[model samples]
Target chain A: MLGKIKKETAERWGYMGFKSLFSSGIYFNVFAFLGLVTIAGLAVGLHGTYTGYHNVYGVTRQIPWGVLISGYIFCVVTSTGLCLVSSIGHVFGYEPYMPIAKRAVFLSIAFMLGGFIIIFFDIENPHRMAIYNLLSPNFTSNMWWMGTLYGLYLLALIVEYFFLLDQNHSMSRLAGLFGVLFGVAAHSNLGAVFGMLHGREFWYGPYMPIYFIVSAMMSGGAAIIFFSCLAWKIDRTVLTRRMERAIMAVCQLTILLIAIILFFTFWKIISGIVSPEKYIAIQAFLTGPYAPNFWIAELGFGLVIPFILLIRSKGINTNLMFIATGFMLVGIFFMRYDLVLAGQIVPVFHALHVEEYSSLLLYTPSLHEISVVTAGILIAIVLYLGGEKVLNAHKFQKHAIVPPGAFICQGCGGIHYMKEGESQDDALKRHHRMRKVDREDEHA
Target chain B: MKLTNIDLEKLIPENLISVTKMERRAFLKIGLVITGVFAGGRILSVTSNVSEAFASGKDFVDQYPYKPHYSMVIRQGLCIDCERCLKACKETNSVPDYGYRTRILTKIVTDAVGRKREFIPILCNHCNDAPCTRACPTRATYKNKENGIVMMESKKCIGCKMCILACPYEARYFNAERHAIDKCNFCWDTRLSKGEKLTACSYVCPTGARIFGDMSDPDNVAYKMVHQVEKQVWVLRPESGTKPNVFYMKATRSSPWDLRKQDGAR
Candidate 1:
């Protein structure tokens, strides 16, 4: 098995890189150079804030937290969902998803690495973030839990990926499952950061965590489609039939979760109307200054368009899948922005609180804030592409197809050569019993 | 006159109250002496209790035990939003440009009518049950136990923005550049630590609209203001159950429903 995998890796990457090094080396180098330049520019700009100006923070007293935190949370939640979906496919007895398992593990690490970069920039004091969380833990705080869990999630993913590479299936499966659990914990805790706030009338509710989790799955589903298409574009084989079935199931779940999101959105708007604490702000969102962004950007582009595309596609057509995924990704970004900004737009001063919905305490992102958010996205893309290139992290074998001869049980890699009287179940049961007997015989 | 061990034992009342049914007359004579000594001891204890209560209450009233670190406890009715407090704070602290540490929040009641448009200077309340302190994940925001002042260490903050949502007074401000939370500290570095007068806002108020002193100390300006005025007070959002220390004098039903009260039912 080790020799087979190493031979395959050498064939795929060695040929690809040797060919690219001569023909497309300049193209690859240009992208690599651009990535380096972007990082350098970001570092320089951030460093210039030492002149006693508040350039690093996109916050003011009126709107203290800006886009950076919201974006960071979005990345982390998305990464968590990816890790979970991938782990279920790889580590557990979910044989249907086995073909895509390796790729999933690889992507899980890449996405999490992307999340880490965003968080690193968001913290005011990054150096203390590591030691402080351990030495002086605030167990009550959701952010602390989110941070700690994400850290654990990262460790699990790395372990899971490496063991798979080493062909240590038992350990890999255990690590993968552990990663999934921690990923869920981390994602939900991040959502709870907003949901647990009692004073912010807009954010006070039980739904934010659900909203975050489902949206993450939606983005995760879209991300899989996007990445899978990229795989095909680069001439990698189609995923195994069983893995494709699992991806299809995720697509259905994605649609269902989106429907749930719609229901929550409607009720959320209604609750805002009735709540005395939030009524003024609710009205502001409906007909006030934020109405355009709330309606056009968040609801129209993010929700409605993506919903229509996803429902129409039914998870089958590759082109539709790509289009739907793109729509949802764009929409999710808008949704995050609207969620972050709308709550603070309404001025807190009661006397100044307008009777009718009017403009909010207006704010626009500063250049520094924009640059930082852009940097986060760039980091995610660059890391994902680089990981794929180096690892030969193809999720499926070249031209992987369900040919007539492909009816082998993934559990034992045995071809189902059914005897005249035997049923599928009987074959499976016999296989299971035989394997156990053989193990006992070896021990005896 | 110094009693030895034998003399001390004799002075004690242990043998004074010996009783036997046939010796009742003898017992009554001993009982009288015992009762006399016991009464003297009771008087001494009662006097000590009174003195102890008085001494503690005096210090409590003087507001010697508590101090504000970063937050100020505001009295709403006393404020006219003269902007003098704002100006004074800006000038004194060399405050960097972002938002005011001490700023005024106005609530226009009944169509901004002259009688109904209420403006109160809002800052950090330094609450006994501070929501920010409770929500902070790092324990970066803390309450000073000795003086009941809510304090924050900016150097330790991660800027997650959870405290902004948890604060009832909307007291927390974010330093955009530093990515740290910021708010008023009642001029602790300048005023409170030095045993000086009230903060910049209090000192600037010509109408004595904002009075500052130890609310714990009855002799202090804060204690007297609250006691003497007989004014009804309000907290911005007590429904949060933060037990805010800041009082809004002459507050009415117009104030938002207490969040702490509403939350308790849940």
Candidate 2:
């Protein structure tokens, strides 16, 4: 089995860098170049963060956790989302979600790697966090639990992905369960990382941990819709009825979670208004500098627009689902950003009515900080395309309709098997709801 | 030296403040009382158990949590905003130019007489119920068992800055040189541990504005200063329930300068 995967993977990559570069077409080349440029930007960002982050990053003693931390949160949130979303079908044996398992697992791994890469630059001495984290464990810290659990979470995901690729069902199922446990634990603790803080009144409460998990589900559903739609467009493969249904189910979930989050955000604001201690921090997002991000990105684009779009689509319009997912992904990015930044911008001494801390603190991410975040995102995209180009075919082949011997049967739910017609993808499209794409794209 | 309840109108001189206690009702001087509001460039005592349930030393702690029961008392009225303690702390601890170990806060409260700026010096209160230590994951910033000083073990810090967010006073800062969170440790590394009787800030406070002592000892000057009923003394953000060791009191000696009642629910 190992040798079979090795052989297939080697052939898919063209067995040579120059040959693969020359052969994959202009669009592939453009994507690869974009990925490389992002890496270069990452290099420059690393240099800045390393040489003197104080001089380079827009962070100050007042606002230490800046955009880089926000970016890290974004990636990890996506990773947790993908893992939980994928596990519904793959682990719990849900039929509609089964075909989504492989791509979701692969993307989840990619997203997590992106998260780790961004956060590595946030710490002053990343080396020390490694040593002291294990040598002197502090079970009390939310960050400690978050870091350790995510480590375990990553390992479980990789194992789950590997088993899913090999079609070792038992092993993959076990690994998927572990991944769910670790992912959920890590993501909630990430919430507590903000929730547990005392002076930062906006985030200092029980709501954060619960909100993180629910939002992770919302994110996972959106990620699947976004990536899967892009996959159908690129692979040009007429999505099997099962695949479409799976996406619709995910869309329904995406909308539900968005509604839940919208509810959560509403209460958060109301609660803030009622509490004087929370006045400055809450005021920042409500009518202060961060108002634009909260209004446009977080509320409008993130929840309301996509929610209306998805509802109107009736969960069947693939185009509408794709568009809504796009808005959600953008909104999710700001959601994490606003969460991290809004909590920190209120200077700790603001309540004391000191001249030094009278106003809310300001932190606009520097070019280096922005680049590091952009690079992390670019890295995720690159890994996604790379995973698609090399691995999706063999994994998806069995699920695609090969039109066995011209007998179009609606007896099965997906791909009515060309019932009594000529052997062509065009012939298959005649009965299929989606248009003709490619076997090379789907089963290359 | 507990002063029994009295008609504060008779106690304080008429020019500064006039408080009249009628049977059960205490009438104020007809000053505008702003409840939970920030406006007109004035900040009232807002952290008044704002949202959280009130926490106190007796209710929050079962017994003395620390060995020394270290504490501080600031004579708020006497503080002329000299900032000598601030300078002394910076010099002793090598606090960076941008950061401070201690600071003085001035509130220009206006009444019928005129504007009177009251100085309230602030620092790491080193609360027995320190939120920073509780929030720290690695115990990097923990309460020192022997002295009750909240200290930082720089090496153990992950630079996550959870402690910074947890501190109500915003006492901690990320020191690039140390690559860790730094804060006031009551001059533990500089003076107190070095056989000095007082912290640098207390030692250099020429007017007895900042007093540091062992609260466990009743004879300690700091204990007497806070416990006395003749003067109104209070700690900042008592609602925080950090049960901070530091106490704030006004100078007993009268000055010609215009003032208000310093004893408000002390």
Candidate 3:
């Protein structure tokens, strides 16, 4: 049954077999190194799980979350952002955005799976979570909502990708719509998991959910540009005028998002300084231990420098976009790390004047924790590389002849009947033009 | 004598009725009232007061959600850093040396008039609106409906440690042996379920610093103390709005030594 499904899928989607994975020496070498790193990371994670997370991880009773949690957040935030950005094209019928739809969808799924793998190691009883998360669901819990919604989002994304590969645009669009909804809901709830905790002065606010969604869009935009540029490097054939335009559009969106994030950060710092509870945590970012992370990585690499680079590139230079996005990805990773650590460092009892908790608590990720986080990144890279090879770099035909009978349009999902010997591209254009005329007539 | 070994004889109970009046007035302005004082005027004594201590908007002393709302009242001033409670709790609960189910926090006031140091004993607040319970993706840590003690199902715990971060009191720790987040459950499985009225910490408290009882029973000392409206009482980190079941208040040295014996005799 598995062989039959694989054979049928290969025939339908034109999947390249296992031998094709090792065709290019550079690709093979990169994959081999990443695969080894991923395996080592997974081994370390399993060892930690078997021994005890407490013994292996840097987390303590004071700071229960560490770099691994940040890593997981980074993955999911990027995944949700990708889903949202990609949905704007394929699901919402945006012409300029269509070319990126397939690659973004594939990466979103890969990143989400990577996130799950990281969180699985972070959780002590991950198996129990799978069981009780369904059996004894806690509706009020933000964590529960986040887990459930993300799970649904992943499922929707998988279905959407499947239909996209099968060339069933209507089905893919339906699944993509659900994927977008679930992704947004899941991502916001992930933010609420931190935000709703009134005890955590640093994280407790309405800002977290809103910021997470906005930052997700920024991260998503950067990821697509970086990966597309990388894909172009790997296979020059993938870069058509349509693909170039899509990347340019995404670059512009990324620039806008970076500016918005900077504005959010500025306000976050300004507001946090005045609030007595949040002052110490905010100060840590401004001039204390976390100053470098905030100033150099989060602001410089994640926002300011990328903003400048993208503007200089004029959203046209793929090489500059690549360099800018590379810095952005690194900066975004540190942004998540700082967010998680800052909230926890200000010991819960800091306000109570207890000698033990008078100063900020410290946490440095253990080797095992670092390995697990590395594995998550490697998993995403490996999956993306594998998808590129197997799915012919997620290429879609720009022009084709229309078949007989009514077919669902990729853009509008509207059924259009084609005349004999008519081209698919012309039919779509004609349908769009007629719809524009109808819309104009309605306005009149 | 060293400060650790406090001399009970040298301690004088300063008449703070004026100060107490001011505190009561301050509390009253915020719609709260003091309840009961214990240990007959000791410099360090246990008191309990309640007026909507739970986050559910229900009158904690009046409505009493649980049939027996198990609660702990820490006499903040009475804790002498003896640490007998810690030892007893560790032994009873099999708590590892690296982790604790209960702890004493030392706050030294360099400019205080009489006492320069204060020991604040802390444990699970067992909040009626438990953030840990809410934060747990799985129903691993949940507040008991019957008695209101926050109970843990270790098997169900996915050890996300969300509960640890959610706890305002810093009462939880990752128990490597259990492979789950461990916390003070008022000795429910070890003592309370085994027909003991007090937790190991409360029973072994030589200074009667930790008082454990069912606040839902009006006849019970915990309930009577919380309902009387006499002495000033407070809970730690009230701004978190966890609505903790644990109460804290000052005690006098008038009869500090007799508290344990008196409660034991009851």
Lowest summed lDDT across 10 adjacent residues in model 1 chain B is found at B42-51
- Per-residue CA lDDT of model 3 for B1-266, tens digit only, reads 36878877677766565468878777755542212223222211222224534435445444357878888877788899999999999999999999998889899888754457899998999887888998888888999889988988988887788888888989899887887889999999999899998999999998888878887777887766555445566778877877788888767654645666656766
lDDT of 3 by residue, A112-167 (tens): 98999999988887888889999888788888898899989999999999888887
Give residue A402's lDDT in candidate 3 (0 to 100).
Answer: 27
Interface RMSD of each: 3.5, 1.7, 1.0
Instruction: Work out the TM-score per prediction.
Output: 0.75, 0.83, 0.85
Cα lDDT, model 1, residue A51: 34
lDDT of 2 by residue, A297-341 (tens): 999889999999999887788899889989989999999999988
Which candidate tops TM-score? Answer: 3
> Which ranges in model 1 have alpha carbons more than 4 Å from their true place?
A1-53, A56-58, A236-243, A351-359, A396-444, B1-78, B91-94, B106-118, B159-161, B174-180, B218-221, B224-230, B251-266
Report residue A71 deviation for candidate 1 (angstroms). Answer: 1.8
lDDT of model 2 at position A134: 87
**Interface DockQ per candidate:** 0.24, 0.44, 0.59
Which predicted model would earn the best DockQ?
Answer: 3
| Every prediction: chain A TM-score | 0.80, 0.86, 0.90
| lDDT against true structure, model 2 | 0.77
* Model 3 chain B weakest lDDT span, ten residues long: B39-48
